[model samples]
Every structure is written in structure tokens, then in C-alpha cells.
Target: MVSLSGSWLANGGGIWMLAAFYGATAAYGIHVGDRSSEVVESTRDVGDAAANFAGFKISTVNLSGQNHVSPGEILATAGVKPTSSLPFLDAEAARMRLEEMAWIKRATVQKFYPDRLDIQVVERQGYALWQKDGKINVIARDGTVIAPYSDDPRYVKLPIVVGEGAEAHVVEIVEALDLVPGVRDQVRAAIRVADRRWTLKLRNGIDVRLPETGLDGALASLAVFDRDKSLLSRDITVVDLRLADRVTVRLSDAAYEARQADLKARAKAKKGSNT
Candidate 1:
């Protein structure tokens, strides 16, 4: 009985050693096969071997969270197609192509096993239209120029700003406008000149010329005058607040004549009353 037990243990140990040897051989074979397949696939031209790729098959195309870009468009732009080989697929190239689109701010691409590609994208957030050099352009919140100028009516409500260095000074203008009461709402356009002075065109076609120096003071004074006197409602064409102390106004010719005549009539009535 002792001899029989020893023989059984030896047989079991031999079987285990054989199984481990076979498993190691199988793993090495797989590694070699993968390396050889990669070499052959890398040497082959994808464009020329289109018919060979047809056999692998694309099981899934996952573009679930895409908002700005169409899935079909994304696939076409990435040059990804049905039955594309996992080893030959270029995820970085696909991602770069999608990033070229104006609406897509960033894109990430990944490959899933068997036959699936995953794509994720972030779209640009359009903030406002920037006008410069007689052209209107769309700008993002970070002040990046998104698109070129166009006369499209969709952007008609955007404020028109002009003059040298307007693009760099846009944030400052927005800040300044916010400080002035009612000026931001009534402003149709803000023009910046080469000298860095600002001129604002109101919705009512009235121009407010800000001072090259002491602009904040001028804006404050204008705010006070408007609040107390409703100066904007008057028949004034232009308000020149360039000087420090005085506010000069350019009145329409008709209104100016009427005001002068009224003054003279008042004086005549006073003299007659005195007599």
C-alpha cells in the first residue's frame, strides 16, 4: 500500500509539470504571433488594402455625448471606417482632425477591443461679436477669435466696436461700461481710437465723446447730469465731455433757433409788463 501511494504522487507531479510547460509555450506563441502581425500590418498600406480590412468588421461606433459635431461627420473626418484593424488605427490623428473643427474646442479618442471606437468632444462657448477693421467676428469668453467677419443678420444685435487696439482692450471696455449707469444698456457701439480714447454711440443715435484724460470723471459727470436733468432726452446730437470742468453740447440747428427765439420773447414780455 505504501509503494502504491508513492507511485500515485509521482504521477500527479509529472502531470502538473507537463501542464505548466504547455501553458508557457502557448503564451510565447501568442506573443510572437502578435509581433509578426504588427510588422505585417505596419508595412501594408491602409488605403491600398481596403478590401482586407472589410473582414475584421466594426462592431460599434460610440459617439454618445457629441453635441456640436454630427457622428457621421466625426467618423468621416477621423478617416475611421467599418472593419478597421485595432493595431493600425491612429487615435491621435483622429482626435486632431476633430479638433480642427471650429465648434469643437477639444476632442479625445480611444479604441475599444474587438471593433469599437470611443470619441468625446468639448464645444466652444461663443460669448460676443467683436467688430474691428470694418469686420465683425465672433469671440469666445477667453477672447479667442472664433470665426471671421460676416454681414449675417444673426449677429445684428451685437455691439459694434472699432478703432486701433480694440481687440486687446475689449475687456477694459466691458468693465468701464458696466460702471456707468444706464450707459451700458443704451450703448449701441463703443469706438476706441489710436489714442486709446473711447467714443460711445447710443441707441438713439447720440454720440458720447469721452475725454482722452479724466475719462472716468467725465463718465461720472455725465451720469449725474443724466440722472438730474434727463440730458439724453433733449434734442442734442453730440455730447462732448472732453474738457475737465465744462460739458459742451451740440444741439440740432432747429432746436437751437427755437430756444433763442423763446428767450427773446420772454425778455420782451418782461419789458411790456414793467411799463
Candidate 2:
């Protein structure tokens, strides 16, 4: 006989149930023609009893695709120790906390009925080692810092970049080196010089100075020079390609001594011819 008519648009099982119960109790009070302030208290008790009877306590939490960070670490960061009832647990809040971790890129939290939670995490993958101020850290492709670098075999194959603001320019350097296939293997590290140009440290203790602008063209010319003259194999300490047109070479001590000797002998012969 209770007809308290109005729109009650509630969604989700828990929310709908709670709203419907409260609404039904209010309507029933009007039909009973008696003041029943105890309806609210009674409904709350029944709701608590139903939630407990449904086995809504969180007991098991399953995490998938979590490799770099252990579940214990996630649980600690999430601040969501189990034994919390599923009906009142804030899943999105827990997920936000998990995403705050550096290793975790994204996270999805799913509530399984009764007593379990399933969490799927996407961890960041390191693209290179960033060496700055003599310290190394692992960096992702998008230049996000993953962790401090140690000599891990898992990331041994990745390129190592050095100097200030090197992470931001890693992709540029790698792509330019890719264009110059001959120069890639000889390069041991790509170091940012004054945060402008790149100085590539070669495997044999030589440095190749690349210009700041028009890097692709410079690399192309270097690649051509390497192909024609085997320029990389020369006993040189530095190859300065910072200039627009010409390349300047700084020879190793042995190579410099040999060149000086040849020059001195040619000068002596020219003086004798003049006499």
C-alpha cells in the first residue's frame, strides 16, 4: 500500500540494493500510518548481515603481467592490505596508487565476486642506459626514467647514452646512427656535448664529432667517407665533422709522429732542390 512514487535511477548491484532498501523503508513508513524511526537502524543491520553472508571479504589478490615489481612491493605501495570488504573497497584509488610507481606504466583493477581481486599491470621497458654525472640510470623509449642502471644482462644489448639531457635526444642519435650503418658498430656511446651536438665515442677510443644541425646529411657524408677510405679504421683520435663542408682529423700520437717525420723529410728535400 506504499506508493511513494518518484524516479529512482540507481546502478550497480550494491548501490541499487542500498538505495532500493532505503526507498522501500521510507515508502513503508507512509503506508503503516506509524512513525518508525527504527526503519533506518533495522535496514543498516540487515544490510551488514547480507554483506557478511555474501562472503565479500577480500582474501586473494591475483596480479598478472607484473615482472619488474614484486606483488609485495605493489601491495605496499597500494596501501590496500586485504581483509577489506569488496563492497566498500576503492578500486580506482588503489589503481592510481599502483600507477604512481616508476616501473608501472598502467594498471587495471578488477573485482571478482566474493573474495578475490585481479590486477593487471603494464611495466615500463628500458630502451637505453643514460649516463649522466658518472651515474647510470635505465630510461624508457619515451625518456621516462625506469631505475638506476646496473650491469644487467637483460639490458646489456641496449645503447648507452652519456651527458646532460641525453635521454631527450637518445632517439634522435640512434636514428641518425641507423642511417649511417657503417658508423653504428664503432660507436660505443653517444655523448651530448653542451646539450647541443653529439660526440660519439667509438670502440677504439676515438671520438666522432657530429654537427648539431643537419645530422642526417653529416652522417650520410661520414658513411660515404667510411665506405671509400675506411676512415674509421685510421689511427685517429678524433674526426671533427662539426663544420659544414670539410672534416678535420686529429691523429693518435703514433700517427702524428709518423706524419711529422714525413713532412720534415719533404721540407728538407725541397730546401736541397732550391740550393
Candidate 3:
């Protein structure tokens, strides 16, 4: 029961007093139902209108912790209508609705008594870019797809994973790559082949084929080869590490011909020296 003071009674006049009384009674009878939703909605609109006329309308909004999502999106998701009054706004319900958005990790909605609404949102971070079926998306750290790729400058430098099921197991490969920065730094994309093993595409167009088993050891060996023999800098097309026994490197066509010519020249020199 809302007990109005003498001063409020004097200021509200007869029409405002009657509306406020009816609104208060309607508020008390509010309930959730599919059949009576229209009735409830009308009553809510009436109550909020009356309360708004009494200067309880939500006129100001304070929003924070939002970087990627726009303020309008949050307000719309929260169902903050133009005629919504502080007393009628369901803060907890609004918060749950806000969190349904992909970017919003969590959200808090608060209504101040007179005329203010406050919203705080913790947004999810874009961890990597995932490409599949000719579409690219920004994915969260846990591999949840946040949104379709828009070439957003913020996520341009993120590591890329390609294939159908790569998003689900991206964390494992990403963590393994992190352990070997020497190879990781040069990786352009981690392509999931047959949804089984990963083939890393380097920035220089070199494909590093990793074994289905012993992934870490293969990457470590590749790093050592790069460090000692400057293998990565050489004119190589593919570095096949699928076989545990050896690292098979396929040289570029030009490099292969150059190597063959050098071997022949050495052989001819030896034959001439014998003469």
C-alpha cells in the first residue's frame, strides 16, 4: 500500500490522484500469462504512464564496460521502453535478456527510484578468426562464434583456424603453438585437414605438415631446423613431418633445379680431376 503524504495529495490534484491509485492497484495484480498478456501489458502501460507523469520516468541511463556492443542494442535488448517507469522496470529480467546477446558475457541492470537506469556489461573477447564453408567468423576464447567476420580491425591480427570442426578444438592447437613461438610467430593459419590433424600455413607460403601424433615434438623439431639450417628461409614448398623417422622437405622448382645442377657440376669436376 502506497501512503501519500498531505503535500503529495495537495499537489497531485484529483485526476493525478485517481490515476495513481488505479495504477498502484493494477501493479499489485500484475502476473505472467500467455492468455492475459495483452491485459497485463495494457495495465503496465497505464501504470507506467501514470508514474511517469509523477516524475518517476526513466530519463537518464548510465552504461559502462561496453566496447564492442552499442548502447542502443543493450537498451533495446533490455526492453527499456520510452514510457517505462523506474518502479515498473524489471531489472533482473532486463539483465537476463541483455546476456542473451553473443557479445555480452554478463550484464547488470539497475533502476534508480526517480529517473535513472544503470547498465553494466562485460563483453566477450574475440580470440580468433574461424573460416568454414566460405564464411569467416570471430570466435571467443572457448571457440564460441561471436559474429560473422567483418574485417574488424580489432581482430585482424588474431590467429586463423579453417575447416568445419576447427572451432571446437582450436584451443588445443593454439596453446600448442603458443608453446613454440618460433614457429607460432610465422604461422598464418592452422588448417584442420579431414578434421583430424593440423597443417600450419606459414606467412611465407610454406606448409608445415604436422603428424597426427606427437604434435609438440614435431613443432619443436621444425623450430630447431629453422634455427640451425635457416630451413624456413630457404626456397621450400612443404615441410612434411608426418613421418616420425624423418623430416621430408620439398624444395621449390627453382631450388630443386639449382641443387641438381650443382650436384652435376661437382660430379663433372671430379671426373675431370681424375683425367
Best by TM-score: 3
> How well is each residue in 1-275 modelled by candidate 1, as lDDT tens digits?
00111111121334445454345345544544677766434433342133223322244566755654677778778766543444345689789998888767888988766455678888775555777666777665556676775665655555556666666667766766778857678888888877478888888988999887776678878888888999877898899988887999988888899989999999999999999
| Clashing residue pairs, backbone N/CA/C < 3 A, model 1 | none
RMSD for each of the candidates: 13.9, 10.8, 5.5
Name the regions of candidate 2 deviating beyond 4 angstroms: 1-54, 273-275
Model 3 over residues 145-218: C-alpha lDDT tens digits?
Answer: 88998867898998999997899889878988998898899999999999889999999999999998899888
Best of the two (2, 3) by lDDT: 3
TM-score of each model, in listed order: 0.61, 0.77, 0.79
Cα error of candidate 1 at position 103, Å: 2.3
lDDT of 2 by residue, 202-274 (tens): 9999899999899999889888888999999999999999998899999999999999999999999999999
The residue ranges of model 3 lying beyond 4 angstroms of the native Cα positions read 1-30, 34-37, 53-55, 257-275
Question: Higher TM-score: candidate 1 or 2?
Answer: 2
How does each model score on lDDT? Answer: 0.66, 0.77, 0.83
Residue 79 Cα positional deviation in candidate 3, in Å, after optimal superposition: 0.8
lDDT of 3 at 210: 90
